[model samples]
Target: MEAKENTTPTPTTTTTNQPELFTASDVARFCQVDLKTIHNWADKGEIRHFRTPGRHLRFRRLDVLDFLRKYGYPIPEVLRLGKPKVVAVDDDPVVLASLRKALSKRFELTTFQDPFDALVAVGSIQPDAMIFDVRMPGLDGVKCLERLRSIDTTSHIRCIVYSDAEEMKKNATEAGAYDFIKKGEAAELRDSLERLMGLERE
Candidate 1:
């Protein structure tokens, strides 16, 4: 009866976690480009990168995904971090449409035509960033920004005030906005967002 005892063993499974930061050679391999090209990109500020204490270059996973998406490169499965969640609140439907067209590909965008509604949903949305219009009918962007800053739950969300009135920049900054981008400056907005993602530029 003792010889009839079974000797089955349980199989163990292992999982590998992807890195949050990558080396130049790692990025090169991911992009299918030579190491020199990666260096060039870093030098030219075409990709988001930082230098280690030893002067070695390092890139964040999100930044690599941004580079791949911006340049039409195929994103490797290992490097596919989800897009940054963004909430754009603007009273103007047209402006919201333009934002959708411009940033939809790079960000997981949610738009609100009413500032109060945006505020109500912000806690639940937990967006990485918010795009606010300086002037709106119900709650102006600056006030919205102030409200969010006062709330502990939404205070840490990066807020960007998108407006054509250059005069509002000061107020926006005072209201705790991370940056103010003049409307129609798509490139500047993209650059600001890249910086928000912790990209270091020389």
Candidate 2:
């Protein structure tokens, strides 16, 4: 499997109001990958900030952190290097853990009992696809999908909706979800995922 994005987000103090004040060394450590990787980050526009009159490139502290998370750089509650490479979001802890257990051996899966955290992590994990419950505490599946689409990096990834509420199926499909598997339809769910993963292969 691919290692944790191979990043190096070095830490540093930023100029109070300046969003761009990172040094080469700061980025090196913030990303936790390597200095060369930092340069590659800048080159890729994954992270960028300012330039001095002498043309010295600088990075923002927040940007560095965002990039670190986006790349799944071994942060809290995240297991980057593993199988399945799947991310599943549901507010119910029992359900979340159960799904993780069922799928962990089959895929590199990560579970988030909170949809909000999953929303934030999506940008980082860049999971090939996602499965989220419809009725979350703060964000419903459709709303969460909206948020996901708003971010350029995670927009194109396939998402599946799993909700007991049949009402969400239309909304999820309209929102461009790959499919909305009514809760308990494990076979249908598996089929949807197989179809999606097949598309990835193509």
Candidate 3:
């Protein structure tokens, strides 16, 4: 009897073989950095990416948008809206989502999880200000502030870090935080936000 022939055909990826939204070369060009720089950013947790089961790195287009919006890095000699961008970085997804939903109408708020990655976005987005949580996974609020000031791109971006701990607030402010808010009351937050945006404070 003849051996049964194998009938199952292996599946092939047809839809643009690239599962990644961007490659190192692509990121180098977009962020105006070298491929090595992109790699470095990845290593430092400056950029958020996902690892495939095959060990390939995949970047999110949303993350890229947030990055560009962070540095106020304008589109080169292209269509520009000239509106300001704002970034909110936190470890808690719930808080991040809530902030985005609440402030999406008024400000161009981009939310992120990792503080270091948020700084990377700040370089690209050039947002007018930033709101970050004191406690995060990678970089803490104070460290994030130091890094922001160190970078020319985000040197002027307003840094705001809030915490329930008064000690954290004091430490954050001393570390060059623009404003600190307690975890509760949204009233103070609203007022501070309005003033920062040059809106009439209520």
Candidate 4:
């Protein structure tokens, strides 16, 4: 009998490639500005940028596009869709889902069910604003807000705290929360967020 060869299928993996990143020179050229100006924008957080492990600045293509839109610069055809970034943290799946449904249209929304992950993101992404749940498993919202305010990099971010417990509102406000929304008040929260971001709800 001939020896049979064993044939096994190997699993194939896929990777989601990130969008092309824009260097400072690329951004300066696209914005019709000097390279020094691009550096200044990144330094002051006027534009979003990522720091490489080697400490070099890298700009996101979409973020640069958004900056152009905000400054009335003509957006390129590939970069026309620009919206403000907002970070929302909640332990409840329903609340997160509601937030996505409500705010995704007007803003580039990032949601985190884990408060710890949200805290880390705030420091790195430096979102325009944040919405947090007052009660969560670890690092409750009030404490989280306080920590953020204490950090110079994240201190200026507007923070809103929401909870089912009415008494926590005072705690949230004192902790540097920009506004407090009672839990389950999705419409009110949406309106408040719009007002905070200077966006008119449609």
Clashes of each: 0, 17, 11, 0
After superposition, candidate 4 runs with Cα above 4 Å error: 1-82
What does candidate 4's lDDT look like per residue over 1-202, in tens digits? 1111112211112121323466888788778999899999999989988877897778765466568868978655443334556778777877788877877776667777777766765666556678877888866667777888887677667788877877888888999998888877878887886666545458
Candidate 2 runs further than 4 Å off: 1-84, 199-202
Task: Please name the candidate that would achieve the greatest lDDT relative to the true structure.
Answer: 1
- Per-prediction TM-score to the true structure, in the order listed: 0.58, 0.55, 0.55, 0.59
- For residues 67-154, write the lDDT of model 1, one tens digit per residue: 8878888767665444566778777777777777777666667777767777777777666688877887766667777888888667
| lDDT digits (tens) for residues 160-193 of candidate 3 | 7756766787778877787898765445665666
**Residue ranges of candidate 3 with Cα displaced over 4 Å:** 1-83
Candidate 1: which stretches are off by over 4 Å? 1-80, 199-202
Candidate 2 lDDT over 52-97, as tens digits, reads: 6796777544344455667766332221222334677766766665
Top candidate, metric TM-score: 4
What is the alpha-carbon lDDT of model 2 when measured against the actual structure? Answer: 0.60
lDDT of 2 at 194: 54
Question: How far out, in Å, is residue 73 in model 4?
Answer: 22
